[model samples]
Target: MEISQRHEGARGTISPSGSLVAHSSNSKLRPATLLSHSSIRTAAKEVSTLKWSSDSANIAIVSNKLVEVQAVEGHAHPTRIENGSGSLGRFVGADFVGRHHLLTSWEFGRAKIWDLSTGKGTDLGDLKTTCDEPAWQQRPESTGDIRTVALLTRLAAEDTLTMHFPELSTSMQPLKLPTVDAKSMSWSPDGRWLAVLDTATASPSVYFYTPDAHQYRSYPSAANLEGDGCLGVKAINWSADSRVVALSRYDGTVVLLNTITFTPLAVIKHTTTVEQSNLPPHQQTPIWREAVSASNERSYALASQPVSPPLSRTKPTIEPVELGVAEASFSSNGSYLATRDERMLSTVWIWNVATLAAHAVVMQHSNVRKAQWHPTRASLVILDCGEGIAYLYDVATSSAPLAVNAPLPGSPTLSWVHTAAESKLAILAAARSSFWILYPEGAESVSDDARAGVEVGGELFEEGASEDSLLDILSGRKPALPYEIEESYTKMVELEMGEADEGADVAFDDTFREKKKADTDAVDPLDDSQIF
Candidate 1:
């Protein structure tokens, strides 16, 4: 097959025998280059989810009945495992336990660890746990080892969360939760805290717990205060440092809380002005007349009809209405927060963490499917709007987001793969026939620099600073530094001298010219007698 590659300014297209083509438009930010595209056949045509191994060498694609593990670096045959037997039920989800082992869960709260090397599946004991979705503790620093996994199970007429250590084959004591209906759970990046979101309560709350199943505190959502009948949190995101947590509520507000002190920091409300659809009398009268004429023409029309007055002409007024937040996430360094509202599906709000102000607003033509920050780079975000294009926003580099089109057909889902050497993105097309991996050009050095900039005194700058220090700095309550004081004094003195010099020059020059002109005029007036 003949392959053709074309480039026009910031845009690029690749065509292979007209079967597949990839297009990307350049921006101030670097565009992702299509590295590899591969097609694989599966028993099921749809893909439920995609996950990358910690090493970034393999990817696990889960379907309804089977799990497919594909290698990224080679042309190796994909491994398919169908562990769904009599009581095991269907495969719900799968996560990489390590580089060689894969943990697959079932609908009946059963789990199995499949060894990819030997093609062996070992089932865990009858734990009767709810494995609908398991939240694995993230350990970025570890060597792809399964540490602790949290699973939910209904016990004693209430939903209970339990921890299981896969390697040791032991489970932790069941932790009693405040709400019986826990919507979801998330572990901090450092694996220090676990946050469980409870939506099935009078007031939705987010409970914080230690890794050892110790409940520390809970923050009840403010959604019920609007008298909206127990609105819940749609999403929860923890800052990279695990210090601040953002809760996206269904009441159109995002609450940011200080996890250290368990107090609210700010409540961000997203409001949009909508024009009322009340039409003017002139416009309504024409439509009413047309309808009346049409009704009179009908053969079976009623003889008596009620006459209705036309509405008075008035200008439409715009009123701001709050929109529920659909998604919210913090950047890698916690410098920026990105949120998407449910009503306004095509717009993204990027807020500055330091100033609590909007840094950028990204509007797309299509509804956005996902907006995720880079795993290692701060202020960089990737958005997929199901338009076969990926929009990238890097606040540190540019104000405008860049667009990169996928090589495959249909809407594609995105997953970021971070490795020791570089970071890559996996785009799975909607058809599930093929997938592509893209690597952003010139992103490695930029990511390295961003990671280095956030580290201060051998600890993350966000985690090292105390709450009081940050509050004082943000509120402008700190004392001025010596250099700042001296600089202010110098600037004040310079401004005063400059103004005085300008005033003196104008006054002296004007006074001297006026005196000279007066003297000449007076003499001329007296000497007029000689001419006579």
Candidate 2:
């Protein structure tokens, strides 16, 4: 009510208040619309999950008690699926099978498929396992085509997997599995194989199978990746083609395996080091400490403070901590793989999937919250830097970072828009707010596939850009110096801007200062290599 009122009293009356920031003109993304889910109200729902359909026309919102399908273009769903008996044993997971069906699982060994088109529901037999990590195979390319979906649930009788045709209400051949607690699983891009990582203990045992559950190959324990050989698996992701499987441990060691033969392709150990860059005010980067103990609450469940030390933890370390891969993702084309060096603001590694070697080590950001490949482009990538900013990096083009002031309302989810004739991206801030980013053509920057990769950042070092050069480029990794140096540097930048009458844009002024620093600073040229 106050936002629409003309009566002036205080800050609420100001339409363009100082707190309500206006976006910069240098950016190409224009706000299109904001969609709010304020109508969603129910005590039974616990943090609803939102997923878009292949055509980007509908969204499947799954909550603790019900799975609701909402058409994105404001089309009403004429029929609703009957969710049998509310609160079905704690909703474990859910996903869209094809374009018209939503597959959901429950913890009490129950799995159900709901056909959105017909509003018909099918109940599969008891899964006999803790239902979690339910993933669907690649959807059919043709719209409205039935999708083949697989569910990996360990039954009390035996560890077995079930396949189903939600469209026809029929079950495929049930395949038996060897291990329980399948920590992670994913489908190959072609929908032929299912890769399952079963880490019941510290031993990282993995299995690959056809959709029918026929085991193709059993992989050696990535427990070997651990010093004690006891830590369980942290994360696993399949390449775009499903030919390669990337598995990571908590200690920042990434191991890639060939999906066909289940053989280790490459093992990259990510350890931080200092490097040489003469950009003034060189300071030593603090060592990344490993997580010694986990709190009773999950990391995501804990409330976040508005301000805290960038890389400081108060708990004293009695024993040495080990770092592991926090998150890992494959590019859309499976040409590149990126891993988050757990808990470290510096040290995000990119690898060439074809060569199975480290392609580039980017020690540039304070923290990389998330990384995902462009939907169509293989070399292009977008990174969410925990803060309100997002960066675009094109390893195929340059090694500079393009910063965008994208202030997401909550947890950031950046996805490419799949609508035809619209090369844009969408940002979903929590479940309430939505924003569309349109990089207009010929507007200095456009989201075109052919001319896309250019104008991106991260110094374009050769294929094997060594660790030293990357560390040198990262401001946080210089040599450890007193805190006053950082403070003085900040003061210097502020003073320079003031001397110039604050007439220039802040970004441009900072860029000019960095340019001047680069010209005056003496440093050895960066050396690159052909590790591939």
Candidate 1, clashing residue pairs? none
Scored by CA lDDT, what does every candidate get?
A: 0.55, 0.49
RMSD of 2: 26.9
Candidate 1, residues 245-359: lDDT per residue as tens digits?
Answer: 8988877789898877567888987655322237443322110111113432211121112222221122444765444787898988888998877776666778888878666
TM-score of each: 0.57, 0.60
Which candidate's TM-score is highest? 2
* Model 2 ranges off by over 4 Å: 1-47, 63-65, 71-77, 84-94, 116-119, 128-132, 135-146, 200-204, 221-228, 274-323, 407-532
List model 2 lDDT by residue over 122-211, tens digit each: 766565464344433443343454566666555555566677777678977767777756655767766667777776363436677775
Model 1 TM-score relative to the real fold:
0.57
